[model samples]
Target chain A: MEEQLIECDVLCVGGGIAGLMAAIRASELGANVVVAEKGNPHYSGCGRRGNDHFETWIPEVHGADKEKFIDELLKTAKGEILIGRDILRAQFGKAHEIVELWDEWGIPMRQKGKWEFAGHAFPGRMMTHIKYEGRFQKTVLVQQARKRGARIMDRIMVDELLRDGDRVIGAVGVHTREDTVFVFQAKAVILGTGKCSRLYQGLTPGMMFNDGHGGVQTGDGRAMAYRAGAELMNVEMPQRHIGPKYFAKFGQATWVGVLRDAEGKPVGPFVSEPDRRYGDIVMEVNKLAPEQYGERGRGPVYMDCTGISDKDAAYMRHWHIHEGNVSLVDHMDAEGIDPRKHPIEFSTYPLRGGGLIVANEKAETSLPGLYAAGDEAMGDISAAATFGWISGDTAVAYARTVEHGDVEVTRPIIAALESRIDELRGRGNGPDWEEANIALQQVMTDYAGKVRNEARLLQGLAHLRRLRQKVDTELMARNQHELGRCLEVHNLFDVGELTFHAALDRRESRGLHNRPDYPFKNPLLSQAHIVRMEGDRPVTDWRSY
Target chain B: MPPIINPDLCIKCDRCVNICTEDVFFGSKKHETPVITYPRECVHFNGCVDVCPVPGAIWLRYPMPSMIVYRTSSDYRAPPG
Candidate 1:
């Protein structure tokens, strides 16, 4: 048996957009960096999946209409779309800089007519080339990182962040294939681990290979920060989206056209139009009145593609070409009615968005020398794609501010990481990571999902509290791989509990933080709720957004 | 027609619910499988078939006339301005 250890100025966990972007920036700043990716870095996370719409085609087609298209985002986030406006503008302003970086690294982005070739609007299609896809983009970035003298380890899972006193030094993770645990020492650690969707039940579109597809973001990075004593914000404001469930299997269909409710009733503009935004086509069914849909009570709204113009229908068929344009035909066959003739049945449910982490515009977590990026850290930045890129840039800039050469700040942290690795090795079979992981996922999906009440939140919080106690005691992992899973479960518990506590404390609904018991948005509670680990207990505070 | 469903083998992603044009299928955001609504409206585009990641969750059946009927703009239109 051999023990493996590595050293770098900065160690980034996860290889999604944030991690790759961070690695590149760190290398440019002249630091030894390493990235450990649990899966192939090139693939898209929840971000890149489905049509590549928002940041892609919409911008090209609309141009100044960008404001109008982005209006959907603002509306989705309940009119606070500009919450991360500063961060988004910064990210978009540097779009060309990022593209240049990608170009210099040999990654091909469509500059000419790739989007037109794909039948999308022309203006919105800049940087629209379908190179090896988002995952391949990660692959290319990782390769570029290697060229710049950064080391990369695949299939390595970071189980826990190594801490010394109040500051985080590094992390201890397990290398699956080798079945051995290793420690990495660093002056700074960047967590870009992405979202935790598998925490919920329904299938999310991207990265089934990773833990949370789109349901419950595992909240691994947040947990690590909390355990090491860092502040967290808005963990309870889960971004629940109502997506076309059938899109995953049947290729995408034109949903906006054939809107309907759960009982197969038509609740069109023929009913309530003023109260809802967009056409009745885009409004959620719950937003419509019962009389509008003719009775069985509205469960969800469906898009009736049958009523859309032929041109619109064709556009939809072309848009969903990835799944072979089977959706149009599926609509025809399943209902035995021509989509050219009838409206489709549809419903609305919940989808978890990139949960927000309460950091200032700079992507800095509450911890010193540690920054959170990507889905791992939640907040206003989570909603906007452009803002996500900006958060990455901000994190990189902040990381550069720290001079890694100053051992006075980083050396002890690295040493502490080594010690933590020894602690895991000593505590053999301490906890069952997989079961605990499932339990946490259930807690998030069942209680914290879509419709939430104080009772459910309290119940989930209590369960998380118990899980926290058991995580260090009853859970046991057979090997290093299992050990990482155990850590992920522990992390989810920590994150879920924080989210529940925040949800409970908020006492009112606003944006994604919906408490059914307090459905209406209370201006009194419009401020953001903040929490951080103070010793063994989590401390809470409030800040105006 | 019992209306098309292969319960044992549904990945339950609910792509069918999104694609259905006749208001025939629905599912919960949290549920694994979708519920068939207005089974009569299903036109059997067979789109749900290939789109389904799982092999055999949906069963295509004959369209029922009792369901609401719709016409595309290409077929129905105002005379002229």
Candidate 2:
């Protein structure tokens, strides 16, 4: 396959919300921009399925001081992680801008009054969320970007970053179906690939193993950045959300209802606070379910939406469909399960990559010319939108200062990557990439999952190292799809290794990094665990929060 | 659970082939009709159907109760179980 060279003033990788926003912003800023997406931008990343609401801080809606909103945002970190204050402030400060942009793009945000908003998350009474039909979020974004003269290239799976000295110059990716390598040379590149959600066993079984976000989010952005010597923050702290045990295929069903026992009684006190962490909520349910409903029925816990009004139920159903899980309505109908009647069984699943790609207030990574946004930059949709906006302006400014310098794609780098792909294609017999991936997930889930200790993490790390060896030597891919899978597994291995090592290093129990041995959050360990490539190996260092 | 492509409706544009991140539609050669080679890999995000220029060319059947039951049973073991 011949290497195709493409050049742009700003190259936005992974055309999810962040990438799309960046491309739109950059192109609007008068920079030649190209967005290389693994899938169609209209239905890529978590936003492929629309979200229930956009969490924003409109002063009229929030009614809180900017400092209070920032405090609430930092509270979500649970004192376990050090979130960048500047980044948080920027995201909060720019929330109204994002909402305004979405409004202009014809995204239907449900506003109650001149200042009143609908669907705020928790704790705060100020309605921060403007309920929107987000099913066409990606499509709207693509349209907006295209209207502003941004080039959107789909089916380009970027696997490696091309760097000149310490600065990232471009990226190399395979055109999945065409079997062509795309070498995108750019003055600036923004990565918006979503989190690594498939490292553990997901709600689904078989080939589509991880179903929380989408099968496509394999932590490609984080892996590429890590390999390119960019620092990743909080890699050990995995975020999990509670959802229906059997309905993982239905996408995220907001935990709007109460947790009830088999006796049709509320299992726990319903805390409607905005600052309530989903993890804590899950923990509460886990503890209460087995105790109250263990002997009463077969199913342990259920999210009782029975108390919700018919109008609310209808709204929930509409939100579910709008979120791209159209089949969910059919599934619910066929099961004869009405939210107004029976409760739905609940379970927890991992959300995104544990740590995020470390970036400054401008969403620029430590490596020059490379920026991150969205889940890759470690925030919710509002944060991602804010960072995406900032990164675009930042990249455009950076591009103005620098020329499209000659990016020498060294023979050694090309040969090494090609050899790995060839080896997978050529192998006749070995462990199937899917089976290896399953094994990897099993190891991670068993030892390094939600419940963890130092010993188990060490064991998981050792097991992961062995699995990495198998993936490196015996992995096989007969076609382009399998080749993509092989690459995903390779990225997954890097993520797993980094996560395990980071977990091992963080002895105290903090936010999502639950440790049985260290049952309490250590004040000393409040710093961020920064992971970077030291030569061929990864090293972890702690920075003060 | 692969998507059921209506042969009668499909224009064979291979839009489904290009759009699927799961690569459920296996058609390597140009103009080759996309086949559901890896049925179980389909997560049913409906990207194929969404991208299909022909309306109703690709559709998905709701997964069977037994399949959902089995998956939930196997995948949802509580932590420390």
The top-ranked prediction according to TM-score is: 2
Question: Stretches of candidate 2 above 4 Å error?
Answer: A72-82, A111-116, A120-124, A204-207, A254-256, A271-299, A350-353, B11-15, B28-33, B50-57, B62-81
TM-scores for candidates 1 onward, in order: 0.66, 0.89
Candidate 2 residue-wise lDDT, A1-545, digit = tens: 67888999999998888899999999999999999987778777877767756767777655658877667645543233357677667777887888888877877655442432443333333344556677878779889999999999987888898888888888888876666778888999999998786788775544444375767788899999999899998888876655566555534544456665455565555342212122114333343343335455555666666656666776677777776666566666766667666656665544344578988888989899999999888566777777888899999999999988566755456567777878988999998878888888888878888789988988889988988998899999887778887888898889988988888888888766789898998887767789999999989998864
Q: Native-contact fraction for each model? A: 0.10, 0.28
For candidate 2, report its TM-score.
Answer: 0.89
> Total clashes, candidate 1?
75
Name the lDDT value of residue B31 in candidate 2. 67
Query: lDDT scores for all predictions?
Result: 0.52, 0.74
Local lDDT at A75 for model 2: 59
Question: Every model's DockQ, to 2 decimals?
Answer: 0.06, 0.26
Worst 10 residues of 2 chain B by lDDT: B65-74
Best by lDDT: 2
lDDT tens digits by residue: candidate 1, A151-173: 77766667567665545567767
What TM value does chain B of candidate 1 have? Answer: 0.59
User: Could you say which candidate leads in DockQ?
Assistant: 2
Q: What's the lDDT for residue A360 in model 2?
A: 81
